[model samples]
Target: MKNKIEISDLQVHYRDTSALNKVSFDVHENEILGIIGPAQSGKTTLLKVINRTLEFVPEASMDGTVKLDGVDISTMGDIYGLRRRIGMVLPLPVGLPLSIYDNVAFAPRAAGLRSKSQLDELVERCLQQAALWDEVKDRLSTLGTKLSGGQQQRLTIARALSHQPEVLCLDEFSIAIDPVTTMRIEEVLKTLQKEMTILLVTNLVQQAKRLATRTAFFLNGDLIEIDSTDVIFSDTPAQQATYDYINGTFG
Candidate 1:
């Protein structure tokens, strides 16, 4: 399979603390690459670096390289252009104060898409992709923040999809939503994988086993192991530590 994103000797430092240590991995195109680890294992840090959002962190610095589609992201002239190719959904749902329609429309408009018909089609398509259209189609003008937590979470996914990113990064996206909604979104992700590569970071090992083509285990900022989901969840993993973590013996 072709690689959509590649990381080599990647390191992230925040002040005196190291957040990611020499992490290296490849995200295959059109595949869902799951990242699983305990808290503070640098999973989120990895996503931020991939999307270049880590630059906003105070005292944060990085070494090594991250490449998207064979192009070094660090060498990109337009940060916004780079970000537009990667969509990110966070653990917590963050809805803009704008109406649901406007929230999903925000990205395209910012990209200079002005045709009302185009915006309408984009909004519906994204919302549908997010599994949110049926719930919000009648309330397009309503404030996005007014929706339920689960609805808002799905809304965030729709907003992320508005840019039609080549890569989608989801960091513990189901953490705050109810199980039913989480499952629904999981189904959406399975479908979306046909359209874009996905980077999924979740503490839930079972979720990774269910959705990921490949899984990577992280421990104390280190990438312990990365392999096919079958191998990662096998009776004996490539690393004893990975086996322990997956077996509920340790994180």
Candidate 2:
């Protein structure tokens, strides 16, 4: 598989604190790359950098190379375009204070898709992709925040898909969802892998094993090892820390 995104000797710092140190990895096209680590492991920071959200942080700086489709994102002329190509679903469900239909249609509308028929089709398709259409299809005019926690999380995913992004970055999407809904979303992700690359950052080791084609382990802001999911969870790994972390010894 071709590399959709790549990082080399990447380092990020917020003021005097280091968030990531000399990290390097590749996110292959049409594959789910799982990132597993404990809190403050730089998992979220990595996603923010890929989508260019890290630029918004005060005192945050980076030194390294990050490429998207063989092009250096740092030299890209359009910040909006870079972000539009990468959709992000954060841990919390932050639904827009708008109608469910409008929430799903927001991205396309912002992108200048004004045709009602086109917006309708886009909304339905994205919602269905997030496994949320049937439940909210009839209540398109209802407020998005009125939905349950699980529904709201799925709605966030649907909204992210509204732009039809080339890459989807999910940061602990299952945290707010029930196990049944998490399983459902996992299935949805498998289907989505056929259409776009997925970057999944989750603390759930088992979830990574169940979904990711390849897994990368991070600790103390360093990429310890990246390999097939099976190998990362096996009796031996490239790093003893990785083996220890996966075996429930310590995060």
Candidate 3:
């Protein structure tokens, strides 16, 4: 498969604390690359760096190159365009104050999609993909934040799919949702991988094993190892730390 994203000797820092230490990896096109690690291991930091949203953190600084389709994202003139190309879903479900329909339609509308018919079709499609269409179809006019936590999380996913991004970055997406809802979204992600590359930052090792084409393990700002999911979860891995962590010996 072709490389969709390339990170070379990437390093990130927050004030005096190092977040990512000379990390490097390639995300393959239409594959779900799972990032597994314990807390403060830099998984979320890595995602923010990829999408260039790390700039929003006042004390954050970065080094090295992050390229999307062979072009360095830092050199890209249109930040908004870059962001639209990579959709992000955070751990907590953050719903816009707008109605369910408007929340899903927000990004497309901002991109100048003015036709109501087109927006309607796009909204329904995204919602269906998120496994939330049937639940909220009759209540599209209701505020998005009014939905239950699980429903709101699905809404977040639907909104992320609104612009048809080339890369979808989900950081602990199931953290705030129930198992059934998480499983539903996981199924949605499996279908979505046919269309876009996915960066799944999950603490759940089994979740990665179930979905990721390949898995990378990070520890205290270091990339311990990366390998096919089976190998990473097997009796042996390139790094003992990876095997240990996967087996729950230590995180």
Candidate 4:
């Protein structure tokens, strides 16, 4: 498989504390890459770095290179264009103060899409992709924040999909949702991976096993191991720490 993203000697620091240290990895195109780790393990930080959002932090400093499609992201002139290519969904659903239809249409509109018919089609398609269309089809005008937690999460996913990103980065997306709803979104992700490369930062190990083509284990600013999901979840991984973490023996 060809690499969609490449990270080389990447390091992220917040003042005197390190978030990630000399991390190196490649994300294959059109594959779901699961990132599993405990709290403060820098899984979220890695996603931010990939999308160049880490630069938003006043105290954060980064070293090394992150390339998208072999082009270094740091040298990219269009920050907005770059972000649009990498959609992000955070742990909590941050619904905009807009209607469901408007929420999904926002990004496309900002990118200069104006035709009502085109916006309508894009909104419906994105919602369908998120597995939320059937649930909210009749309620497009309702405020997105008025939806249930799981529904709002799905709406956020729909909004992220509006731009048709090449890469989708989800940071603990299922954390606030119920199991059934999480399963529904997981199915959506399975379908989406065929179109876009996915970087999934998840605390749930089983979720990774179910969705990720390959999995990476992170611990205390270190990348412990990365391999096929089968190998990572099996009795033998390249690293004992990976096995321990996967088996619930340790984090």
Residue 6's lDDT in candidate 3: 94
**Best model per TM-score:** 3
Candidate 4: residue 125 Cα off by (Å): 1.0
Worst 10 residues of 1 by lDDT: 175-184
In angstroms, give how far residue 90 of model 4 lies from its true place.
0.4
Per-candidate count of clashing residue pairs (backbone under 3 Å)? 0, 0, 0, 0
Q: Candidate 3's residue-wise lDDT over 66-159, tens digit each?
A: 9999999999999999999999999999999999999999999988899999999999999999889999999999999999988898899999
Question: Candidate 4: lDDT of 221?
Answer: 91
Q: Show pairs that collide, candidate 4.
A: none
User: Can you give the TM-score per candidate against the true fold?
Assistant: 0.98, 0.98, 0.99, 0.98
Scored by Cα lDDT, where does model 4 land?
A: 0.93
**Candidate 4 lDDT tens digits, 87-140:** 999999999999999999999999999999999999999998888899999989
lDDT of 3 at 58: 95
- Tens-digit lDDT track of model 1 for 101-206: 9999999999999999999999999999888899888889999999998889899999999999999999999987888878888998999999999999999999
Give one digit per residue, the lDDT tens place, for model 2 in 1-251: 79999899999999999999999888899999999999999999999999888999989999999999999999999988888899999999998999999999888888888999999999999888888899888899999989998899999999999899999999999999999879988999999999999999999999999999999999989998999998998898889999998889997
User: Which segments of model 2 are wrong by more than 4 Å?
Assistant: none
Cα distance off (Å), candidate 3, residue 178: 1.6
* Candidate 1 residue 131 C-alpha distance from true site, Å: 1.5
